[model samples]
Target: MVSPSPELALHGLVLLGTDTVYAVHMPTFTAPHDFQAVLRVTLDTDTYRTARKRYGTSALFTARPRTLLLKDLQPGATCPADLYFGRFGRDGEPLGEVSITIEETVYVGHPAAEPRTLRYVLFGREQLYLSHVLTRPPDFDQVVTAQLAGEWWASGSGAETPARTVTVPDRPDDLTGRLRPGEQLTADGTQLQVLAEVYLETADLAAGGV
Candidate 1:
């Protein structure tokens, strides 16, 4: 990637350094916040961190990611505070320059992963959730071997769902976690099945109403 020109003005929190990644905890704000917004960086070059979500801000957000390229920038580097926000892999690039008085300096080191926002490899449908985000993708054209815990939710009746861990080894693209009925996950180009799906219906949007 080419160096991020000093002409664009960034518009979010600035890192004192690039030696570490930042975990953002924004206060609950009303609509229009675009909470799932991805954090962009400009330490001589442009890079981005993936937002954990693309919708509501109920979930904790991990913003201000560290890109692999930062390993080269020396400490005390400066960055402008005119960052831009937009859809993932879409538009929202920022530009312009800032006066020395307003520019922020790099105080930390670059995070291990580029696009430094941390992620979870969790699995859930409705009430269920994924355990982690770093869970590696299964090898191509191969069945996935994995372990999952499903005893967290007390959501069953008569025969309450047992709280026991299960082995989900070598199952092709087996996906677990919050998902809608129409959506599906794929492995090795195969569509994964939805063991359990969860969702809510609102006056503005419903499963079929949307």
Candidate 2:
């Protein structure tokens, strides 16, 4: 369950640069120092994503020499820069801490059927599926979508009214709520919907499907 807290996200941004260059977070300066800007990015290392999982690292970088300025930081306005991070400012105030638990993957998927061919994907390959599966009372087939003309990427925060936007492809499928799992719901024959559900085999169940 990835309920993101503003504070931890800030820390994640900071830790992203500790080993090599210092990272900065929402920075405030006094007087003349304001004219100088800082770079939002630093020389990143290969182990970049791995370092993001650590906690307890301070989100506040002490405004060091290694950090460069962008264009003289502005009041009430900031640019995205790295090299540690200047943050200019944060999107929202810190909301508090988040805890995560990791173990073998629990998954939901549909068995392949004729016309659909065999198809299975790692659960929650995209954040959207995770949001649905891990939240209170998960339900599937809850989205309206069509087959895409070609491969596409979904964009946008998963919480908004039009939360998911399908990318444009060579052709597009007509949008329809009637789309069903394993149905070739797209135009180019490249898109299909599959019903993903948590499954239990007979061996895992108590006697007589109890």
User: Per-prediction TM-score, please?
Assistant: 0.21, 0.19
The C-alpha lDDT values of all candidates are: 0.24, 0.24
Which consecutive 10 residues in model 2 have the weakest lDDT in total?
130-139
Model 1 worst lDDT window (10 residues): 201-210
TM-score of 2: 0.19
Q: Model 1 Cα RMSD, Å?
A: 16.8
Which tens-of-lDDT digit does each residue in 1-210 have in candidate 1? 112322222222321112122211111111221121112123433332232133222222112222211222223444333333431123434432331121222121111223212232222222222111111222011111122232233332222112121232333222333232333454233233433321111221111100
